[model samples]
Each structure stands twice: as structure tokens, then as C-alpha cells.
Target: MWLTSKIKQLLMVMKPGVVTLNYPAERPPVPKNLRGQPVWDHQKCIGCGGCSDHCPSRCILTRDVCQELRVMLYDGSRCTYCGRCADICPEGAITMSNSFEIACDDKDDITTRLELFMMTCQRCGRCYEMEKSNAIDRINLKGFRYDNLEQRALVRTTSETFSPELLKESDNYKRPSDKE
Candidate 1:
């Protein structure tokens, strides 16, 4: 009776034999709706910081180097792959790619850095419309952001214009201690 039961189990296992594929040599096709990794289109991106604001994991960072220059960094290591950045982006600049294998030794291998040069209006000290129909008007922040890229910290402060004082303050931002 034991031998018959063992034989029956072996027959069931043999019915679906050799289902595993040689991963490195023969890769499986990525699904159509896979939300793997986020890809950015710099041309379409206006450095609005919408993606940074919407990221649940806060992996996205934005730093305003100057009135004309803004630096955007996307750290894939801390990202939750929620696709919120892609969805919140007004310019459709962020897109989720099908490449899911992101294992790497160095953090820079998966990091994405973008330097966006903004054209500001001389009168208002605000970003000018890139196009007649461009949605630059929909940007949430009125002026500049001073996020710390070195510390990987997001500074929620903004200035209506280029303020060196605000930049200095952001540079000195300290994390709250548990003792406090």
C-alpha cells in the first residue's frame, strides 16, 4: 500500500516535469503590465519636483543649485517601485520599464541623476513656459528647493526667489534626535 502511494505521488510529480528555465541563458518575457523600474525622459521633464513629492519611499530628491539649475536624483535602492512618481508627473516624463533585475554592488549603478536648466522669467523670477501649451503653470512649488543631495535628505522649504539665506538654512538642517 505504501509503495503504491509513493508511485502515485511520483506519477503526479512527473506530469509537470522540467518547468524551470535556464535563467541566464534563457530569460523569460516580461509581463505587459510590469511596474519594474522607473525611467525618466529629461526632455519632457520640467524639474517640477512632483515625482519627489509623491514618492512614498522618498527615494526621489530635488535640489535647486541656482535659479536656472535644478538637480534631480532618483535612488533606486530605497524606492518601493509604487509607480507614484510616474503617475504624479504632469509632463509624463517618468515611465516604469520592464527591466526588473536591478541587483548591483554599487548604489550608483541604479541611481539616476538629472540636471535640468530652467528658463526663468526676468520679471517674476519664475520658470517661463517652455511651450505655448506647456503645463509649467501646474507646478506646486513657486520658487526653488534646497534639498541636500550629499546627506540624501529632502528639504521641504522653498523660496519665492533665489534666496541664499534659505539655501544656507537648508544646508544646516539636522535630523531630530530621539532624546529630544
Candidate 2:
């Protein structure tokens, strides 16, 4: 029985080398659903903060509130690749790429930072305003921020008091001044 078990074990361990991967020589093909590392998709991302909100590890950080917040900061050491952030992203912006070779000697060197453009909601079919764009541009230019006003260019108080639902969602809604 001992001889038979040993033979079976050897056969199982060396069965024609069905595995294709050879370490230090070649790498195996990445599976489609394999969540290796987090990467931001600039165009597809809506900058909704969903991924940041859902991230269990809190490795992802963004400065832009909407359109400009598309920039992302990632700390590879802090990220456990839990896949929660990717799953919660509504726009499919966050995804896991097959980039596992992320060994780094310095901790700070492993941190990655990026900028992203914010998506906007429009009223008259015109691109409205972005919160962090002007501010970031100025900061990238100037030395300091003055009362965060530099970042306040994107704020809109909406002087028009009209209900947005009437203009946008309701097909039958006509301006109150207009009637049959």
C-alpha cells in the first residue's frame, strides 16, 4: 500500500506538466475576471465618488468633486485588492488590471497619484463648470490658495428659481407664462 501511494503521489505531481506557466521564464495568461490591481479608466469614469466611498482599504483618494475628481491617488501598499471599489463603481471606471509586478523598496514610491476630469450636468446643452479645474490649474501655477476661492470657480448658486424637474423630466411641463 505504501509503495502504491508513493507512486500515485508522484504521478499526480508530475502529470505531463499540464500547467503552462514557468516562473522567471514565462508568465501565465491572466484570467478575464482576475482582479490583480486597480486602474482608473479616465473616459468612462463619472467621478461619482462611489468607488472611494466603497473602498474598504481607503487606498484611493481624489481631489475633484465631480469632473475634476477623476484624478485618483492610489497607495499600492494599502490596497488589498478587495475588489469592492471596482464592484461599486457605477460607471465601470475602476477595474483590476493584470499588473502584479509592483514591488517597490520605498513606501512612498509605491504611492501613485493622478488627475481626472469631472463629468458635468448641463441645462442649456452647454458644459457648465468644474469645481477643481481652475483651482488645480492655479495651484499648479501659484504657490498658495487664497481662502479656497481659487477652487470656488465651479460653484453655482443657480440664480434661476425654476424647478429643474419641470424643465428636464416632465414632457408636458411648459413655462408657466405659456398656455393654450
Candidate 3:
């Protein structure tokens, strides 16, 4: 009986079928919804730090070097691919790609960088933010939309300019007399 079972198993194995992938030599097909790794579209990114803020593994880092510049850093080794960063991005900047073979000997090999130019407020002259940000969009401000240009430009004039009284009520607001 054992011999018969062995012969039947051997016959089944002889049939042509896929056993394993010939990886490295041949690339495997990636599924549509596979969340392998995160890829950043710098053109679409607004540097709002939304991805860094939503990253659960703390793999994303955001740094404001000054009012005019912002930097985004991503580390693959620390990432868990939770997809929170991609979801929270208002600009659709971060997207998951099918490139999961991220092994590397050096830790720095897994790092990704993005740089963004910040827009200084023309009204207050102190506040700085992404060229196209939620704050500008929230008030339904016209002429500040990212419609005409592929890259949104910083509006020298904003709704804040119309409401000086509102700015005065804020904590960051400073009177000219206070400067003395």
C-alpha cells in the first residue's frame, strides 16, 4: 500500500505546474493592491508634513530648516507600511509601489529625501507654510487655487489680509508697538 501511494505521488509531481518563482532571473507579477513600499511624488507634494505626522512607525521625519525651506525624510527600515501617511496626504504625494525587495547592508541606503520651498506670509511677514496648504483652501480663497499652474504658488495676498482683526486675536500676532 505504501509503494502504491508513493507511485501515485510521483505521478502527480510529474505533471507540469508552477512550484516556485524563479526570482532574480525572472520578475514576478505584482498584485494591484500590494502595498510593498512608499514612493513620493515631489511634484504633487505640498510639504504640509501630513505624511510624517500620520506615520505610525515614526519612520517619516519632517524638518523646517527655516521659513523659506522644509525637508521631508523617510526611512524604509522603520516603516511598517501602515499606509496612514499615504491616506493623510491631501496632495496625494505619497503612494505605495510594488518594490518590496528593500534589503540593504547600510542603514542610510533605505532613506528617502524631499525638499519643499515654504511661502512666507505677505500680510504678517512671519507665518510660513506650503505653497498650497489646507489653511489657504479652508477659507475658499480665490486666485490662490492650484488650477492654472501645475505647481501652486504662494499667494502674496490671502484672506488673512482681509481680516486684520482676526490676526490680532491670535497668539502669534504682534502689534507694531510691541516691536519697540
Candidate 4:
């Protein structure tokens, strides 16, 4: 009877469990809508301060200092794995990836700054963000929407008689020869 009991215990021990995982060697399946790592699409980003605005921990920051357009920065360390940024991104420029590894030793390494040089707006007297301008132009480049410049601006580099629009369009709309 003891031998039979020992055999039964051995059979139970050999029985397989519900699930088994072979990680790294075999790629594990990722669930749908899995929020992993965050990805930034620079071109789509308008720097409108939407993503930075929604961050709960204030890890993301954007400053249009001196009207030089938006200078954006993101702190991955302070971020609490919340999808607020990815959800609030106006241009759909930010997305969460499937990578959870973010180990870092230095605290400063968490802070990431992405600086963009913008063409100043001559009208608003404030620099028209190139990022915004690019987004606008890309939105409508049919050579028809002349009023597209309404949203664009350029910082006055020098006090010239040229309107920012004229300067920009002069190349396309050339001046008539005064020879007549």
C-alpha cells in the first residue's frame, strides 16, 4: 500500500501546470492595448503643450521662451507609467511602446530635452514655430490656401520693409522689373 501511495505522489508531481513561459528565448505574446514604452513622432508633434499639459506628475514640459517657439522636454524617470501623455497628444504624435526596461543610475539621465529652431514670425513679432509652420504647410501644400500664413509667424530679425509673407512669397511672386 505504501508503494502504491508513493507511485500516486510521483504521478501527481509529474503532472503539468496550467501555464508555462519560456521568456527571452521564446517571444511572449503581448496583450491588446498593452501600454509599454512611449514613442514620440517628431514630425506630427505640434508642440502645442497638450501632452505636457496632461502629464499628472509634470514630467513633460514645454516653454516658448522669448517667443522662440516651443522648447520641449520630457522626464521619463518622474513619469508614473500613466498614459495621460499618449492619450492627450493632439497630433497623435506620442504612442506607448512594449518595452518596460528603463533602469538608470543617474537622476539627470531621466530628463530629456528636444530643442527645435523655429523661424520667427515677422507679424506677431514673435517667432512662428517652425514645427507649427511645418505642420500647417504639410496639412495644406496645394499652393491654394494663401491664408495658411495666418497661423504662421516669424520673429523680426531686422526692421526691414519686407512683410514676413512678402519675404516668404517674394521668391515665388517675384517683383516686376522697374526697367519700364
lDDT per model, in order?
Answer: 0.82, 0.51, 0.59, 0.53
Candidate 4 vs. truth: CA RMSD? Answer: 17.3
Candidate with best lDDT: 1
Candidate 4, residue 138: how far the Cα is off, in Å: 25
**Can you give the lDDT of residue 141 in candidate 4?**
18
Stretch of 10 with least lDDT, candidate 3: 144-153
Candidate 2 stretches with Cα past 4 Å from truth are 1-22, 64-71, 106-110, 117-180
Q: In terms of lDDT, which candidate is stronger, 3 or 4?
A: 3
Residue-level lDDT of model 1, residues 1-180, one tens digit each, is 999999999999999999888998989888998999999999999887878876888889888887788899999999989998887777889999998999999999999999999887666575432332535434455567888877778887878788888878888877777986
Candidate 4: misplaced stretches above 4 Å? Answer: 1-15, 18-26, 106-111, 117-180
Tens-place lDDT per residue, model 3, 1-180, is 999999999889888667897888998788988897889999988665556645667567554444466566787777898787887777778888888888989867877877777675566443323354555233222212111111111212333223433223332333346555
- RMSD, every candidate, angstroms: 4.3, 16.7, 12.6, 17.3
Count of clashes, each model = 0, 8, 0, 9
TM-score: model 1 vs. ground truth: 0.79
Global CA lDDT of candidate 1, please?
0.82
Q: Of the pair 1 and 3, which is ahead by lDDT?
A: 1
Per-prediction TM-score to the true structure, in the order listed: 0.79, 0.49, 0.57, 0.51
